[model samples]
Target chain A: MNEVKKLPLQEAANCLTPALRLAVDRLPEQTARAAEELRLRVGQPPALSYGGQETALQTAAVTAADLREIVARAARDSVHSYADSLRQGFLTLSGGHRIGICGTAKVENGNFEGVRQFGALNIRIAKPVFGCARGVYEQCCRGEPSSLVVLSPPGRGKTTLLRDLIRCAAASGARVGVADERGELAALRDGAPQFDLGGPADVLELCGKQDAVMHLIKTMSPRIVALDEITSAKDAAAVGYAANCGVEIFATAHALGLEDFRRRTVYRPLLSIFQYAVEIALEEGERICRVHPLKEGAPC
Target chain B: MLKLLGAILIIGASGALGLSARQGLRMRIAAIDSFLKALSRIESEITYRLTPCDELIALLAGENDPYAAPVFQDMAERLTHNDGLSLSYKWSRALREAGPACGLREEELGILCDAGSFLGRYDSEQQRHSLRLTAARLSAVRDEAAEDLKTKGGLYRACGLTLGILAVIVLL
Candidate 1:
């Protein structure tokens, strides 16, 4: 990989608050470059996810105040704007790094209002492996414009692969609209994507997934609509609507395997919508485990 | 000639001290007003942009007067580097650090420091409520400062001149 396309380790470290930034900066260059996530908890030592292994930072133990400061920095000190994300248990920073927060849940009117007294924080670094989806793209989008869903367990390269596939489709002059619900897909800043999402891609960052899919269909006239991590029945229904409207769809989901995917009732409707389900496994390296084709009129 | 020169030196020194005392009082009032203006800006920012406190403070520090700017600017920088200090603690520290530069009295600065206890610790609605309360209390303090500047401000200058004149007569 060219140096410019390498993981932005230095910029990521600079984004952290000073104390944590110092700890990350002190890491060996190779470790820093390979680092994937920075996990911190109240009254516990900080840890880094390096090459999929958790390594503890040999610094002072994190305190409640430390967690608050990190939140302040991540939210840019405006917790109000991030309240929705806080209720959803994560906030995506400007560079598309997602910070998962766990704390005392504050519920109001049968819905999560926000979090308070934060207990833990997980900073998931954004690593876009360029051209990793060449196999998946070639396999799924062979003849006709078809809908595909990439599936994997959490921390796998589902998002990474989906992004590359979108780029591939866009490179072939397909108009793709990305529903970047958490800004992780496009990592847009100042109305421009921080990551290269091919040439003919339009992104809507931080909007609701279902709404974005519908909006993309109506306004952007995109040939394909892409979403990240469909988690709800509503999102599945939206994908079905987009598919019926003659717009191709691409999405990612967290599941172990086909059996596990079938067990989840929320994604039942989606099974009929997608032509192929590409399961990514990280056994030896990131490779396609299975590309299962759902039979016509499959059980929902 | 020697006696006259000595008298002139003492009188001049005392008169200058008195003038500065009056000027200090006026400056104290001006500083308080500037602080109120800064708080108003913060309220607007919270209500409208919901900008992050650190970025908001840095922006205010750049736009506000030097006397009032340091508090917000210093807090923004310090919030990032504090060795895990709580928000309230950092807010108090910033007020104290900028107290001398702003020329605000301990009691006056205390009003601001007290508001720091609730800053960024609650929901947006609650934060807005707290800021409004703090701004109201600051308005009261500004009124008191203005009263002091009008009443005792002249008294200090007159006392200094009178004392200087009395000392000169005794020496002569």
Candidate 2:
């Protein structure tokens, strides 16, 4: 039985050993002797394997039902029916626990979803990755209501930074409202956030960022309205609305450099509101070096 | 003498079979993980890449536009065929319905659908060939693993049966 009392996402992720045998040892089994459980264990794996052989098992975890749960929760602003939603394959849980799923993708009546069948599951454990936002905290929150945007090359740690910011902001009493559209920010399962997202002044887990920003501005009255990735013109416009409403906005995106940021016509309007930006370049050395100020272009 | 030789062979085969099953499961899982990672990279790229594509498309569609609509044409013209995700049409179809944020159009999905039909035939054919090759390798490995498992269990049962026969022989 799990510790139903406190759903510790970090702790659960920590227990994921290198292979099957190690994982079972971590489990609290009702056996007379714990070591005896290992030898007698017939079908279980030897260790929690991460690389090579274990990769196949990892992929097996991403089922469509798991996708439905993650996606449904992210769209929490409404009542999602599994009937129409395309629950991809799997969603990685906090600390590397994988959830699998299956379902037909709900698309327009005539249109087909690229994501079909969705009948496998692998909830890769997503550990609460720390030490990511060390440099950006002070620069992001200038004395006045400030807006800072983080740019990454993808797979670099944009969400990791956002998660840390949530923790940092909540600790600082900023009344932050996070609009996690992808259920990645505050991974809450079984009615509680598994990741340490601080105490939420307010959190709209699965709500669209643009819609949530408007709703939070009108109702929640948060000091800062945060979001994950700004993908479209509507989303960029919403950031402007948040700024106009005097609510600071914090978010992440993928881009090469300042030129790439400006070239984006749909997201261009957002540059005016975004005063500061930190670029996350995914290299071994100089991974995160320079901070770019939109007020001052490239040469900085 | 024959029974003893069979028992030795059984134990040896059992260990090898167990190892092989573990390896096969691992290989398939790795492929899936890599496939997903590839998909994510593509998604992130497509989202950002669409802005420029949309601009180029808009300009081309507009008679009084500059910078050439070749960019838009390029998107539709590109030839693709990958076992996991080579079809641009599959991606295009999803984007059309993914709301304004994802840049998918429900009306234009048919264009992608047609492209998918053509592209998918080749893709499926290639995948079938690849799977056949992989399946052959996997089958051999599976056989070895099964043989090993059978031996372990068989040894225990055979041990009991042989002992019972020996007792009967002595009693007679």
Candidate 3:
């Protein structure tokens, strides 16, 4: 069983500028481990976000140079090497932490060239909570493989639950293929997964979700395919196609609850394909996941 | 017999001095040429491979050029034991500490040091443009050094021998 490790908040702080890093390091260990994101903006004191609440640190205000240095360090002093991610306004660090960028876009011919003059950054720390999905696994994935959708509003541990669920399914002697588009799930380094996915898991890193799904189905012939952030029509279509082919699908999406998920037209096609929708939410300062069955006439 | 031996000794010492001066010029030219080649390779690496600055510096260090290699080697070492400093700072410091011994002129050292400021700080196109500009400047300096070697190289040797003969005649 994969045990939950302390969140790598100090590791994330090391990616910041030296002064800012010092300030963050001074935070209490409990606070550091509980932090969800590190927020930095020009002319504002650095802040840490905990479960959607932002707490300002007692450090000096951030500067433009500080922001530039953070980006440079994250890219290993080679900004051009991360041009694609910079254009997409986020950089996934080696430890699966994501640094979201807010900057002036240097667009050419209406195409986004890249970001320049960074104004702010949101460093979302990746906290992999192991065994968080045991309840869902026992309820939905005990016997036969099932297609399921993990749903929640943004920042509600949807991805975390989905990751643990993938590990559980893979441990049950099923071949699991992960389309890690943003590298947040597997965080493969030097062709080896940084996260302990499972013995039977194979990850295609940094590939588009739709293409990765089809490729995984055709080549790997996975019994279950897992992907993060199903946002587009293409992703839904790929999931539907994989379902039709009898390959179990595991995916996550952004919605408040099942009702909100069903109302979104982009997710309607996915509803029929997924037999269960795992809703992850925060209740009384603790995470609560409720699994809802969506077999046409299933109860709310 | 003693007078003749003294003249011979004088001429030999002066000739060696002239040759040493000429060798210095040649060394400078060779250093600049080596740097130019390294810059060209850096441009291609940045444009095509998107190689990081540290890896590129390490690659240059492995080239084994006596003049340019030590500077890159020093940089690679500094990057390996990085102390949270920027690449530009480490690069400029490496050149200041290791550049003069590479037989480059003060102006050439300044040009090379300036090139560090823009490296790994921008997109590929911008980086390529900066590297190309630095290369062109270094190439111009190399051409001037080559011209000096072609025109003044022989002059130093001839002057050394003539001065030796003049000193011999005056002493006799």
Candidate 4:
């Protein structure tokens, strides 16, 4: 597979207010490229997060208007259209960058209406490191598709790995079905995926993960099914059912390692479904993927 | 023969002036009616489809309202090819520029500018509320314009003809 190009940080900065955008632009080219997330809070200077550290942009404190402008721009001046996603506290931009919102919740009878009086925004820039999954793919999915789970605590490139793995699987003549619940993995626009997930892959975007999994399994008849962040019992049940039907699963979970993953009661049921787990860690700003075999009934 | 020609010219010019005044009133009424229709369509789109401001403006531009359609088209073009400006700015600017040609009064234009401020800055319910309020105000303005056309239209025509006849009689 050809190398996938990295999206520039300026693409994410375009969503910021003019002042914040200028502050980010003033950063050194290397720092801007290495940046992962842009953080904005009301009455605070904007900051950039990279290498598990945050560097504040020295400028005027972010105002309520600045935050609102970011939200307005991110929604493309259509706040009503993104009401559902805003209620869930995030809006996915065109290039797959996710903007996490913080504000007063407008709840009606215990149901979330949406957000109001915006407070802060975390714009997580999506840097799709295309070949980052090479080591995991070679170890876990060489000859035949394998059911493997990517383990990481947050921001350790779990989603990035799953995206590349899906691409790798699809390139190898396998029909891969992606359950992109948050519209993050595929970032589909006009029926075309923004991120290259290979030609043979089919994406079901903006649907719940469990329904997407079952729906893909039933309709697409995919050889491999991929999902990001399996966080619920329903999702585990769906993954288990898909595995039972002889379809390989590639998924990610929030865990430090296999032992930490096994300790979580909610994800205990999923352990039996995955044959191997890949744990991602950052050492001196370089990502290291450690693949471990999960023998059923193996001691923790 | 020269006196006859002069009298005819006086009457004809006065009559034309009356007709022009009546036409201006009619045009105002028509412009108000078109704006009312456009506002109603906007409310429906917001309440039901939750269409984005740019897309909604583009849709309105495609409509056949002679007065409002051009303004909507200008706003749509600006929105489509945005240059990092806010929607409120684009919206107000478009209306301020094209609104006079639509025969909209300053008060009516003010209402439209106010509506632009909140066009896409809130959720569906808030947006619909703002649209409905703008429509209500425009509707009142339209009713007044229609009443003016009804009451003063024939009076202007008659006064113009009477003035022309008086001028001819004095000349003779």
Candidate lDDT values, in order: 0.79, 0.49, 0.86, 0.85
| Candidate 3 collision pairs | none
After superposition, the stretches of candidate 3 with alpha carbons farther than 4 Å from their true spots are A1-7, A296-300, B150-152, B162-172
lDDT of 2 by residue, B1-172 (tens): 7766665555556555555544444433333333223223323333334222223233333433121122223433332222222233433443343322222123222322333222222112232343344344434444544564466545544554555555445544
Off by over 4 Å in 4: A1-7, A296-300, B162-172
How are the candidates ranked when ordered by lDDT, highest leading?
Answer: 3, 4, 1, 2
C-alpha TM-score for every candidate: 0.81, 0.46, 0.91, 0.92
Best by DockQ: 4
- The true-versus-predicted C-alpha distance at residue A151 of model 4, in Å, is 0.9
Candidate 1's residue-wise lDDT over B44-134, tens digit each?
A: 8777887767777778778748678877788878877846465677778988987767788877788889877666655577778888888
Prediction 4 global C-alpha lDDT: 0.85
* Candidate 2 residue-wise lDDT at B137: 44
Q: Model 1 over residues A60-171: C-alpha lDDT tens digits?
A: 8998877877786566556765665676778766666778888898877988767777898888877778888877777777744578888899877888888998999998
What does candidate 3's lDDT look like per residue over A1-300, in tens digits?
Answer: 997663588777767888888898889988998899999999999999996799999989999888888888888888888777777777777677889989798888999866777999999887777898888988887587788899998877877888898889988889999998877788765466767787899899778887898888899999999989999888888788888888998899999989999999999988778889998878897889998998865433
Q: Each candidate's chain A: what TM-score?
A: 0.87, 0.67, 0.91, 0.91
**For residues A1-300, what per-residue lDDT tens digits would candidate 2 score against the true structure?**
785542332233322222322334344433212111111111222223232123112212333333323332322211111212223233434433434343454355766532444333233445455656745765656444367788877656677788887677777778888776666677555346666777755776656677888888888899888888888877787788889999888888777766787787876888888877878775654467356777664223
Order of candidate numbers by TM-score, starting with the best = 4, 3, 1, 2
The regions of model 2 sitting more than 4 angstroms off are A1-116, A119-122, A296-300, B1-172
Better of 1 and 4 by TM-score: 4
Task: Report how far residue B60 has shifted in candidate 4, in Å.
Answer: 2.1
